[model samples]
Target: MAKSANPLPPRILRIIQRRRELGLTQEQLARMAGFSLSLMTKIERGAADPRHLAAERLLNLSRVLNLPFLHLVEDELPEEEAETPPLKVPLYPSLKEAQEKKTNVFVPLASPMIPLGATPDHLAFFPFPGPWLVGVGVPFLKQTGYLLVDLRPLYHPQGVMVVRFGEHAALVTAEDLTAPKGYLLSFSKGLPPLWPGDYNPELVGLVRKFLVDL
Candidate 1:
């Protein structure tokens, strides 16, 4: 009898093994990469190639695994000319400038004013008096007071949703009220929505005030 070939491609098999080494089940890896459980399982089982959107999913999984981005590629390419690195940003100088201009400092999500489930499909909507801040990824202690919008569900849901507040309007996810444990927030630009009926206006108002004071 002829020798049987390995089911998954070498690259993909390596990725699956790496995921296992990290003690992440296929479903867990899928959730982390914003992919569905079926899709993740298919990829691991060699029934599907993780190209295009699937490829992007793999990239996210690599980030969670703390592995190099290009490590999954089967063919190794020789290095060409090394490009110059981008200029380093000065933290103190940037902080001073932002302070002088009275810029809003983003507060991290430490403890949720309201406890919620932290599933990948849950959405967290945070309404503020002024602008809204949105961020993705697992909750890091450094980001402890801002609203965390769960993007896992939004991966398949397209179309931008907008919310108007007085003179300032913002865009937020439709299902933005369900988040797990402590919410996730960051200092990135762009505003999320303060949609009506999605949250308790009174509770949101109180949390907004508390975050601003921080």
Candidate 2:
């Protein structure tokens, strides 16, 4: 079967190639553009495709690299130049925060992120109905929240997972699974592990990015 086309429609390939020609690393370009190192890696590697990134982000990188705006975004107009800015996913304290529309944080990402185990139709009506959940003291996560729920687990083979057993949930590792009984895994030094119950939990989602406080 033929593979589908790349989702990176805008073709910033020239900019990335040129940056490498100038002996610049993804980290350096990220610093130059005032973007996260992870964002830069995604852009360079084509993981953060055209539809997924805001035009402003590409423009910022173009400016830092001394490239023409067209070089980074030739397919569509810059987001700031659009009639209306695109809607971003909101980070909520919980599902209730999203429903109440009170004290919810708005993340400037330009992608339609679905929940860990939800379908595309599930988010068709409410595009940004709070994909990110706030959590504290998780490894590689800042104080704000973690976008750790990987919607496409098969696509991403690595990273930690959030599992659910009946009404309870816990973070567990591969080593933890080998135990005879359930043992909740906590990366924090002082926190003790909790055993939810005797039943084995199903794999919910893989943890990916940590949305830092912005």
Number of the top-ranking candidate, with lDDT as the measure: 2
| Model 2 Cα lDDT, one tens digit per residue, 64-84 | 665554545555656653333
User: Which candidate should be chosen as best, given TM-score against the real structure?
Assistant: 2
The root-mean-square deviation over C-alpha atoms between each candidate and the true structure, in angstroms, is 15.4, 12.7
TM-score of 1: 0.36
TM-score of each: 0.36, 0.37
Count of residue pairs whose backbone atoms collide, per candidate: 21, 0
Q: Which segments of model 1 are wrong by more than 4 Å? A: 1-7, 54-56, 75-214
Candidate 1 overall Cα lDDT vs. reference?
0.41
- In model 1, how large is the Cα lDDT of residue 172? 35
lDDT (10s digit) by residue, model 1, range 118-151: 3322323332322433323222223333333332
